[model samples]
Target chain A: MAVFTRGFGGHHPEADRPLPPGQHLTADFPVLSAGPTPNVDAARWELTVRTESGAEHRWDWAGLQAMPAEDVTVDIHCVTRWSKHDTRWRGVPVDAFFEDVETAADFVVAHSYGGYTTNVPLDDLLDGRAWVAYEYEGDPLEPVHGGPVRLLVPHLYFWKSAKWLRGLTLHEHDEPGFWEQNGYHLYGDPWSEQRYS
Target chain B: MNTWHVAQVVAVGRLTSTARTLTLAVPGFAGAVAGQHVDLRLTAPDGYQAVRSYSLARVGRDEVVELAVDRVDDGEVSTYLVDVAEVGDRMEVRGPLGGFFVWHPDDVGPVQLVAGGSGVVPLAAMVRARATSGSPAPFRLLCSVRSPADAFWADELSAPDGVATTWVYTREAPPGVTRPVGRLSAADVDAHVIPPGERARVFVCGPTGFVESAAALLLDAGHDPARIRTERFGGT
Candidate 1:
């Protein structure tokens, strides 16, 4: 065995900015997942929103692309302590998707194709807070980084932005998802460093 | 449950060109099961901290444990552990986290292991446990790497033993071998791994892409999906 000395020091410019606490700037987007990447087929892909009133709104791949979309650049943070700033994405805003829908539910549980679920306040999905983004940096998002379509809620930890998003189930109560049940914070506000229950 | 513990590096050894093994001595350390991982936390002099989990290479009754870290490109914590941390340096670590991915020596029937790159670390622990307990249970390993130079623990894995091992080279094969350099194919897995009919308990560990493809192949081979346990990591 041989001895060695290594330095673990690196500078993060975001640390000096108004970013969240305990997060470092990462120039490259790192892919992190709890399970295998689910490669979904666009021909069969769909996004549905269900409510307690038995109302359902559904959109297939073509239906989603047919609707007007916009490009937005936002900063995103993950629970794993890496934050990528000025990320460019194009998608339909949740506000537009919610136009025809009416519900009394206070909470929304995002469901993914791979059996992953994350709960968020219904208010978080409206008023320009979230989107169902499918394109990244002017191209289709890669499956390894959650493609076909994924929820984009830049306000909270990236986990809340469910990858491979399939539908949204409205509920009167809050429910924890995969990582949330496994010791992750339910609300996951990055600025406050709310990382655990 | 992610509480931090101070661990002193008792020894350091090179496992391969890009990987190194760190033996950390922690006071009052609880024992870990094979396939469980510990989060190694690195804090800079200015107080910035980063944490990455590494699967334990082995489990024992002693307070010290070993973590084989593969130095990844631009990986903050791994670079420190592999290229800079000294034998006497101390760092923060937590747990023996995760219970689902673990394999006990008393587990019955045969065992099938599939690994990609550093994914071999945890599966190696399971293999070592089987060997140490002198269990007669059949064990097989199918490891995928770029080339002979990239393979870890070549000597120990190649030693004649109760475990059957197969190597898949995607970039360059060892001299005198006929298998063309390529990614793991269905035939490679079928030839190397235990068949689904024998009802072998299958454990697959690796990066997201590799795990996805390998598990798909295993499912296509008619292995019981309920019996296959998979753990995935972000490829570096």
Candidate 2:
């Protein structure tokens, strides 16, 4: 993991002015965030899925990691307008996260906490541009920034990196997430300068 | 003080199909400084959450928190707020964030405000504060925009007789426009900003390149770096 240092500001503070307090934390792939850790017992954590065919299945820790995994490095652009260049991750391969495409009904609707949801085209998922990241910067994930496991879709904007991710459902089309449904662009491509319309 | 409240819109609205202003009105809110931000907390149903920071555009007498937002294509939360959040909507928010960049009326330094694009939000606030504070400090603004239509506060922030406003349009010079056409040169900043020196506090905001280049030009002209405050946002 990256070093989380104390301090802030690139210039001088006003007299009697308190120096801005902050941690210079960088995203170290395969590890987790240096911020506060979330409270969720790995043993009690359960992830379930409802297939596009309307079948429900549940799994626990061992069941998830029991699957195969892969590695990837990608850049992320936050809608707030900051771009985190090239982050690396290792996680369950999409091929393992799915069974038959026919079962998914053609799309993937990701379900996360805080009532946030986003949908991805099954083609996008199958195209091998998506995966579930378990290790960042080469270590176990952290909860504060969605550790243990997170849905990391690098090809899209950083917002697609759903933290504290829980489950995925196969859908037939695209659906918006907490930010997407708002006024954000449907396809976030940084090179396109697609800040908005 | 008020239980340190953070907000996230459970629902959102697309007030503008392109750019958006996320309005988080806090009651008796500990208003933000002229230039500061709040980190947005988004808790997904599946339990994944993210905290992204946004700058406060303006802080009026009202306790409302206005975040000037430009929609990022496919930005999960930003999009959610623009396309979804509503008047009754509630979202997690925190802070009167950021320190290096801020302005208040009581401060005695003569001020020069400069901005490009949406970065005008904070500078606009500072200008407003300076105007109302009764501080005899002579203030000037040199803002750059793409065109007349893209100018955020074209009418209000203009100089006398519409000869020129605090803002300059880089794209098209409207007929009868008085400000310089095209990007403002270092000479323009020097000419408009009175007695460019340490007694003047120059603030530059906008795209990272714009802010950096402008600040560099100011420093090159012998302005003390200490008296200059700036905020750099957005870019590749």
Candidate 3:
């Protein structure tokens, strides 16, 4: 049972804008990272996707830019209890990257330039659910906000959207990534309030 | 293993105009290491709950924990913690979290702590722990605040402990201070921080902008990226 804190009338979200449990609405986008930002030049950037069978699909910066891009505005909820609504982003959907690849794997481990990684289910990356976002609010994503490119799985808690994304490896078994290993929920879904494991 | 423990505020102290320290007593509380934080959850009379993470300002197995909270503008949880909450207030706390940013007394090599504003809370804990444990490891702290009045634990940090302390005032400095008031520059970091050649384990904590700029400065000064750890609380 939770203790009631006296004189603590919490901030109430606007009735029209419903947020996930335990989440408060924030007007500002907050950057949360465990290490220093990695300076990734677009010219040298490459994203690779490896399957359980060891086959790999690679895309350099130009290659990614040549693909069909999308402009999406969606709500993003961070595990840290702040939710920002209608964030604008431009990216190639994750499904496009996997269109030609064959994978029997059920999970993926996203790799980032700064040695950060996050796990997500394969199902979450398809059907317009996720993207490799490179632009935000009509501007090139700033390095502090995971420049060059970052994974964008809006349905899950924002941490699952790894920053400075480098590659993805498919796995038959679920493997906990950086924050997951550090006590965060493995399959973080904001709506369910799966914040900590 | 995240378990919520009921903690009662045992004491409260004013740190500055915008910040306060809350000492909580929790039964069966296993101690935490310096630099770890806790998720404090407050429930209202209507059962509406809000949770916020705060770094432990004091660490031990004494069943009592300390948290230093700096009120952010229009911040609901912080406003309550800094102003309305009383000594008898009760809340749910989970953690001693984040292993990557913690400091251990047994750690070898010089430790450099860089803090911005309220980010100094955990670093202060490490400094206190170092003193209490009588750790011989050299420690240095570089703190940036808006002014002398905004610095948390100002008197304690100003007094000579084993750690070498430097201050950068972005808005106002002390009366006799010769340094100009401004944002921390790379030159300031170069002059006060430990040189990269010594391989000091660097820990930088602050608002996102401060952490990014400080970490960049450290990197520009040739510090190894792996050796420098950072924790950023989001804000401009």
DockQ scores for all predicted structures: 0.23, 0.02, 0.73
- The candidates, ranked best first by TM-score, are 3, 1, 2
Q: Which ten residues in a row have the lowest lDDT in candidate 1 chain A?
A: A1-10
- Per-candidate TM vs. native? 0.85, 0.51, 0.96
iRMS, model 1 (angstroms):
5.5
Query: What global local distance difference test value does model 2 have?
Result: 0.60
Instruction: Write down the lDDT that model 1 would get.
Output: 0.83
Query: For model 3, how does the per-residue alpha-carbon lDDT over A2-52 read when each residue is reduced to its tens digit?
Result: 589999998776746788887888888898888888899999999999999
Model 3 lDDT tens row, B1-236? 27888999999999999999999998756769999888889999999888888999989766787999999888889999999989888998887777778899998679999999999999999998888889999889999999988999877876785689999999999899888999989889889999999999999999999999999999999998888888888754
Q: What TM-score does candidate 1 get on C-alpha atoms?
A: 0.85
Ranking by lDDT: 3, 1, 2
lDDT accuracy of residue B65 in candidate 3? 79
* Candidate No. with top TM-score: 3
Measured by DockQ, the strongest candidate is: 3
Docking class of 2: incorrect
Model 2 lDDT tens row, A1-197: 12111111122212232211121112332211111123446776666667867777776788878877787876655545444555678887666666643473776667654344666666666657787777877877766446667787776655566676678787666666545564455566555644332
> Candidate 1, residues B106-128: lDDT per residue as tens digits?
88689999999889999999988
Best candidate according to lDDT: 3
- The alpha-carbon RMSD over the true interface for every model, in angstroms, is 5.5, 18.1, 1.4
